[model samples]
Target chain A: MKLREIKEILNAEVIVGEDKLDIEVKTAFGADLMSDVLAFAKAGSMLLTGLTNTQVVRIANVLDIAAIILVRGKKPPAEAIALAKDVHIPILTTKYILFETAGRLFAKGIVGCLEKVEAGSERI
Target chain B: MKLREVKDILEASVVVGEEKLDMEVSTAFGADLMSDVLAFAKAGSILLTGLTNAQIIKTAADRSIAAIIIVRGKEPSTEAIEMARELQIPILSTKYILFETAGILYSKGIVGCLKKVDGDFYK
Candidate 1:
């Protein structure tokens, strides 16, 4: 789905990168543990978390995530926003809880990050 | 520096885990691009970036970063907040631009992520 559609469905507010709302996002990941996110998240996936810290933004930069959704009515600080702006990432904030938000988005057909495993003969 | 102290300096708003504000952060990495943050950030370090997306949270989870700071006066979506809340990760935001923010924090002695090299040990 397009980043704009996810924003509209969740009734979220855009804090940065408003110009890139039309960006497409195919995969979604939900986690609060920065460690786990780094280990499992695919490159160019959507991140859903309540953790609002500068580390999170840095993590996104490493993984090449398409957008970030702050769930459960939480808002990041101005510093976080400024960093996100510099990176050209679109930040969205919504009021729905974590599970519900994930469920709603999943219901809309957003898939998890795809893992590419090696096979004996051919790539899967 | 302690997360709480960082919060105070940046005048940031904590999104969750108020009790963990006293957590110590020794290093900080600044970037707007998620790709670079993931490439160079050290484990248990603070992240400063402008990109806001679920992927950012996922990257932090993987790297085991101490905290996240969103610069330039931006906020994340509810989905993102809920995920961070579940992970017990503390989120903070500030109004300082990328360069200025890094400068202030650096002036306070917060260093960048550590650099580790991988090579033959006994060559």
Candidate 2:
């Protein structure tokens, strides 16, 4: 889905990257632990997170992740917004919780990124 | 630099992704805290970390990071290695600590990912 579609679905307010809303997103990952996001988020995927800190934008920039949707109606601080704007990372705010937001997106065909690893196959 | 060059420079042991030794790396980031690595690691860059866990490999896989080098001679568990191999993330080990490893890489022209944010013009 596109960032605009995601925004409409979530009823979100775009805090940055308005010009880049046309970007395409194939998958979505939601997590509060930055570590988990870094370990599992696929490139071009959208991140739905509640952790409103500067690190989130930094992580997004490094991974080339599409955008960030802050759940629970949380507004990130000035520092976070400024950093995000500088990097052109779209930051959105949503009133729904992470699980709810993810459910809605999944129902809309926005899939998650977990690959099915074989039960005991040890090869890469 | 290529992962082969990195292994040579760090005198690292390749635990996985040996077939990917030819991969190119443009940047390097060293951190033990997974959050810090997530926040700063550029894609296709090498990560020098002392923390050995499935989470480290997971983070590198998520960000498309090129490889992970465990510093301080730390060895990851079987699960971590298995996970990294599944993701095709090269895992290397070095006896040097994080600081020493970073210095060697920087001297060898490996740059970090800190951009210059303006001087408190805090907009």
Candidate 3:
């Protein structure tokens, strides 16, 4: 699905990268733990996170994430938004809590990048 | 709903607080971020999270959470289990991803303790 559709479904406000809303994403990884995200999130998957810090923007850039969806109505600080714009990473904020955000996206055919965690952080 | 009912719905295991399965919980707050959980989680609500560290137990204890539901098939660290035992907080493990877990629980009438975050973490 395109990021544009996701913005509509979640009633989110685009904080950055509005020009790139046409980006297509089929998989998503949700976590507030940045280490878990770095370890497990696959490239190009939409990252659903509760953290609104600049670290999120940096990590998304490193992982080549399609976009960052802030859950629970959390908005990134100004510095984070600035970094995202510089990195060309899109950020969207939604009022939906992390659970509902994931549930809604899953209902729309978006699935987890991985269903379960295996030992050693390896996809077994 | 009772913790037992949640277990049945999510096919979860009672890793701790097994004897307390009858405990009723109608609200939940899901997040892997400890700070967010601490800031927003209300007392007596189930905590749905992807994190399994001992910090989770400590945070839940400080906030007086009803139970901790470890989603995405993640198990609490042994330290977390021990702490939960000492704190008397129930810990449940489920194979469903966080999203699926929330969907099922919401379908069964467990709603978010706080639907959205207001400014300055006021709500």
Candidate 4:
């Protein structure tokens, strides 16, 4: 689905890369843990998360993510916003909580990047 | 829904609270961030998260959450398991990632504790 449709569906506000709403994203990964994103997230998929740290933008850049969707009405810190702008990554903020955010997108045909999670989780 | 049904649907294993699998929970909150779980999560709701630590048990206890659904096949620290056993709160470990866990639960009529998010989000 195009980022434009996701925006409308979630009532999300584009905090960055407003011009890139036309970008199409077929998969999504949701997590508040940055480590999980680094480990399991695939390239070009949208990241749905509650984390607003600058590292989020940096990681998205490293992974070639399509966009960052912030749930539970979260807004980025100024430094994170600056970093995202510098990297040209799109960021959208939505009022839905994490569960609803994932459910809404999944209901619209957006799927998780990985169908099956890896066998085990490491200590943080 | 009953905790037994949830465990079956998510293919979750009972890490704690085996005797309480019949506990009924009607709502859920998904997050990996503990702060959000503390702030927005309601009492008696199931918490779906990718975090597994002693702090998770403490937070769930403070919030009176009905259960902890640990996603991504994450295992809690030994300290956390002990705490949950002491607190008598159920913990279910699922292999599904956070997104699929929430989507599946939401699809099954387990709704988010907070229906409409509050106007502004804090940093």
Candidate 5:
């Protein structure tokens, strides 16, 4: 889906990347813990996080994430926004909590990056 | 540097993927915060974290990490180990604190995942 559609779907405000809302998003990863996002998020996937810090933008850049959606009405600090801008990463914000945001995205066919594990699959 | 060299450098014990220790690591990321790891770690780089959970392994697998080294003497849960083994991502353990471990590797020329910001370069 286009990031513009994501903004509409989540009622999100674009804090940055307003000019880049046409970016396509095939997958999304939502996590409060950046470690989980780093280890699990796919490159180019949109990151939905609640963490409001400069590290968020730094990691997103390292992971090559398309954009960041800060949930639960959390406003990122100026440093975070500056970093995002420096890296050309889009940042958005939403009033919905993490679970609600994830649920909405999942309901719309957006999914997390976890590799599917079929039941009774081979164990390592 | 080879993963084996990292093992030797840190005196880490291989909990899994001992055979894959020959893998080369050009960069490394050390963080307790998984967010930092995900945001900054380069693919195929070694992950040094103190967090011992299945999510760690899951995230590493998602990020295509070469391996995971649990720092500060933390033991990963059975589930975490099984996940890593299933994903074929090696798991190692070290007694060094995060800073000391990072310092040891940095001294050996292992660098972090952060992008270099040149000073006075039009920031």
Candidate 6:
């Protein structure tokens, strides 16, 4: 889905990057732990989590994730937002709890990263 | 600097979760482009960048970074903030441009990620 659609689906507030709401997103990964997101998320995935901190942005930058969805009505500090703005990563906020948000997005056809390895890969 | 000190140094505004400002930060990596941050940043480092998007948060989470610093006076969107809050990663902002921000921090003794191979490792 496009980021604009994600906003509508989750009833999220946009804090910055209003100019890029229409950016395309192909997949989603939901997790609060940074290590899990790094080890499991596929490239070009969108992250859904409840953790709010600067490290989250750094993780996204390293993993090449497409976007982040903040659940349970949390708001990042100004520094976090500024970092996201600097890196051109789009951030989203939703009032729904993490489970509810994930369910809603899942119902809308967003799939999570799978355990399957790619065609040319022999291991996960 | 500790996250609290970083906040004071940059004279930035805090949007939420004041409970974590004093977190310690040992190193920082600055970039606006997500691709570069991912390719070059060291593990356990803090990210400094100008891009405000969800992907930046995702990158940080993946890299095990301690914090993020927004340079050139940018603000992350609410969605971005929410994501960061969920991850418990501290973020900071400064009005200085990328070069100036990096220089100031470097002058204060923060070093970049260096290419070092371990002595015990085999090539």
For B1-123, candidate 5 gives per-residue lDDT tens digits of: 999999998788899898998888877665555765665566987887768999989988999989898865668999999998899999999865443465466667766544221223224
Per-residue lDDT tens digits for candidate 2, residues B20-104, read 9998876766556676567556688777776788988999899888899886567888989999988888899976544346546
lDDT of 3 by residue, A3-109 (tens): 99999999999999989999899989888888878877888989998898999999999999999999988879999999999999999999888877876777788
How many pairs of residues collide in each model?
90, 3, 0, 0, 8, 59
Instruction: Write the residue-wise lDDT of candidate 4 on B1-123 in tens digits.
Output: 999999999999999999999999999899888888888999999999888998999999999999999988788889999999999888999888888888788888888898547675344
lDDT of 6 at A110: 68
Candidate that would win on lDDT: 4
Question: For candidate 6, what's the RMSD?
Answer: 19.7
* lDDT by residue (tens digit), candidate 1, B1-123: 899998988777787668899899877765545654565566898887655666787788688988888765557667767877877677787755443455456557676563221222114
- Per model, kept true contacts as a fraction are 0.00, 0.00, 0.51, 0.69, 0.01, 0.00
Which candidate, 1 or 2, would have the higher TM-score against the true structure?
2
TM-score of every candidate: 0.48, 0.48, 0.87, 0.94, 0.49, 0.48
C-alpha lDDT score of every prediction, in listed order:
0.69, 0.74, 0.87, 0.89, 0.74, 0.67
Choose 5 or 6, whichever is better by TM-score. Answer: 5
Question: What lDDT does candidate 4 reach at residue A42?
Answer: 87
Q: After superposition, how far is residue B115 of candidate 4 from its true place, in Å?
A: 3.1
CAPRI quality of model 6: incorrect
Model 4, span A1-124: residue lDDT tens: 8999999999999999999999999989899899889988889999999899999999999999999999988889999999999999999999998888888888888887876576443221
True contacts kept of 6: 0.00
Q: Write down the DockQ of candidate 5.
A: 0.02
Better of 1 and 5 by DockQ: 5
Q: For candidate 4 chain A, which ten residues in a row score worst on lDDT?
A: A115-124
Question: Per-residue lDDT of A46-73 in model 5, one digit per residue for the tens?
Answer: 8877688999999999999999988656
lDDT tens digits, residues B9-82, model 6? 65655644478777776666654446546755667776766667777987887887777776545678777788
Task: After superposing candidate 6 on the true structure, give the runs of residues whose Cα lies further than 4 Å from its correct spot.
Answer: A115-124, B1-123
> Which residue ranges in model 4 land beyond 4 Å of their true spot?
A120-124, B120-123
